[model samples]
Target: MGTLTSILVLSFLIFFHELGHFLAARFFGVHVEVFSIGFGKKVFSKVVGNTQYCLSLIPLGGYVQMKGQDDMDPTKVSYDQDSYNTKAPWKRIIILFAGPFANFLLAFLLFIAVGSMGVNKYAPIIGKISENSPAFEAGIQENDRIVMINGVLIEAWEDVSTHIQESVGKLELKIERAGSVQTLIITPKINEYQNMFGEIKQKKMIGIAPSGKMIEVSYSADKVIGFAYDQTIKATTLILTSLQKLVEGVVSPKELGGIISIVQVTSEASEAGIVALFALTALISVNLGVLNLLPIPALDGGHIMFNAYELITKKAPSERVLTSMTTAGWLLLLSLMALSIFNDIYRLTNGN
Candidate 1:
């Protein structure tokens, strides 16, 4: 049941994302050829007016095929005057931005709805500190409520995890114990940890676990919006911080997850009831939105970059240039996916 739900949830998110592009294109008078919820062989398809809506075999991700805007072979399909390429640059930008924006909006709505119903949260308190660990040496004892990390306010235990994992060497921690606040200087122990997906990641560790006290936070009608926005911003910040760590070599590439990890996580989250599933959905949505905005070919950000350049220089990138960049992008993405799958397999066969 959990596995099935996981698949459905993933498909829903991907479909929602594509629907954004489809709707935006139509609204802006761009001719859309196909609105597909997946790739490869078509499983189900129906023509509605000028667009063919379909569900494809692969459920990993989806696409919106607009006339004359096919990245691979733009000239293959003939476009009407209202085709994507014939539209103004601003219109094209909006069409491209709509996909990621939809994901972010979805996450916001999910958070707001969940927050009003009461969400479980953890405080930033220390429960256990490993002997001889950086945390232990720094005198970060049990019952200490962490107030800050390098001047950033620590509202939850989640913040601690984000800052610690991304740290390269030294760290400043502020904690309150018995109503008295104290500052401590600590350097995380650089080590490798194999995540749930069997990927080995070089990360900084303080060897302190979060306090096990959980609180159910139920917001009032007037406060739910603020709480929701706060949660969304927090999650997004953590993701960006982690990505920065990866790029700076503070973390390893093996830390990244692919389809296997997504399925495993979603399946497990499903067992925790609808609230957990909703939270997972929101997190994934934010991740998708942020990742798609990365300036890499074949991504929304890459397309935006090209459009921006054209707007500035009054010339689009040559077809050959686009082809090369997109090909490289596809290769890079496929390589990462293959690596993530291998990591997942290794974790399942041998205890991670």
Candidate 2:
């Protein structure tokens, strides 16, 4: 049941994302050749108004195929007129941006609904602290009420996790022990361990687990809006931080995951509470949306970049240049996919 639910949720998200592109293309009078719900071999398909909509065997990701999307012909201007390439640059940009925008809106709506229903927030009480860990070194004791991390006000234990995971190295913690406010300076330590996925370089040893005392507060309109806005901003910041770590070589390439990881995570999350599952889905959806907006070839960002260039220069790039870039982009994408899959397999075989 859990697995099925996860699969369904994932399918819904991907379908909506692709639908955004499809609808935008249709609105702009662009001829969309295909609308696929997944990649690889097609399992089922149907034609509707100059479009072949398909449900592929794999329930991974989906795509929309716009006519003349990748420099199909040089002499065919009429076909180009009805194609994605012939659209005005602003129209193309809007169509390109719609997918991610839809995901963002979805997440915002989810957050709003959850918040309006009065979500639970865990009480700020320490359950345990590792011996000689950062918490211990900083004079943090069990049963302390964690008030803040790095000067940010925290209402729940998740805020602590979010702040710690996002902030590297030393962190300033505020807590209330024995009705007295106390400040502690804690330094995070890196721990390398293999999981069923890869060698996860996670921050550890400052281990103070939060006590399980959940509280539900009445949800107000302000709270809903504020929480949703914060969620989007914080998630974006976290992604930027991870990217910086990746560039600095602190994060390994093997830590990168593909669709398999998403499925596994979604399945696990589905077994958790509704809020937990919703949060997971929203996180992944937002991540996918942001990732696609990156200026990498073979992606929406790449197409948007070309459009931007064309607008600025008042001329489209040559077919040769676009072809070469697309080819190189595919190769890079394939190589990354291979490495991630290899890492996943290796970790699984080693019982990591």
Candidate 3:
């Protein structure tokens, strides 16, 4: 059931992405030939207006086939008024960008839903303090709830870390212990820690850990929009940063996972309940948005780049260049997909 749910969710994401392109194309008076939910053999198809909507055998990804805009074959061209090739380069760029934009918009909405449903956060209660650490030397004890830091209210464990890292010298922490409030002054020391990307870095630390107590926080209507926007931006930035690290070889390619891993993790999220599922879905949606904007051939971003060049130069790329680049893009995409699948299988076999 979980696997099925994952597949359905993935398909819905693809559908939404392609719908962006389809709608944008139609808006500009371009004829859309086909709107497919996947690549390769078509298992189901139906003609609606001038566009043929289809479900393909592979459920990995999808595409929008606008007239005279064939990613598979750049040689195909039509100069008709309603064809994509006849549209202005700027207009075409907008049509290309719409797909990724839709993914971002969907992610933002998903985040809003998550915030409305309630987000689980660790309570600002100290669990452990390293010996001789700043927090320890200051007489900070386990089970003490951090109420404020440097005159700023600390609502969650996340707030504690932010406050500590941004502190200049001494931190004034207000804590509640045994229903009594007390203030403590502690000077944070530079400490080495491993980040999420497995990189070691030095940062200001008080050496305090959360007590593993969770609180469900639901945002108000106005606050939920801000929460959603912040979450969306953060997710987008995280994906972009991770990609940059991967390209710089700071992150090993062996850590990459494919559709199998997506399905597996999404299935687990489903079991964890609605909030987990929504958060994961939002992250994946943002991931799709960021990836589709990469400046590679045969992608939405690549096509946008091409159109932008024409818009600037008043000339389209030569047929030979377009065909060669598109072919190369497909090859690179396939190679990456193969590598990610291999990593996924390896992890499954090794129980990683």
Give each model's whole-structure lDDT: 0.85, 0.79, 0.93
The clash count for each model shown is 0, 0, 0
In candidate 3, stretches whose alpha carbon ends up further than 4 angstroms from where it belongs are none
lDDT of 2 by residue, 239-312 (tens): 76676677788788878876667677788887777877887888877887787787776777887888899989
Clashing pairs in 1: none
Task: For residues 119-141, write the lDDT of model 1, one tens digit per residue.
Answer: 88787888988999988888888
Best prediction by lDDT? 3
- The TM-score ranking, best first, is 3, 1, 2
> Which lDDT tens digits does candidate 3 get at residues 1-352?
9999899889989998999999999999999998999889999999998889999999878888888878889889999999999999999999989999999999999999999999999999999889999898899999999999999988789889888888898999999999999999999999899989989999999888999999888989989999999999999999999999999999999989899999999999999999999999999999998899998998988898889999999999999999999999999999999999999999999989
Q: How high is each candidate's TM-score? A: 0.77, 0.75, 0.96
Give per-residue lDDT, candidate 3, residue 170.
97
Which sections of candidate 2 miss by over 4 Å?
71-80, 117-120, 126-154, 157-212, 216-218
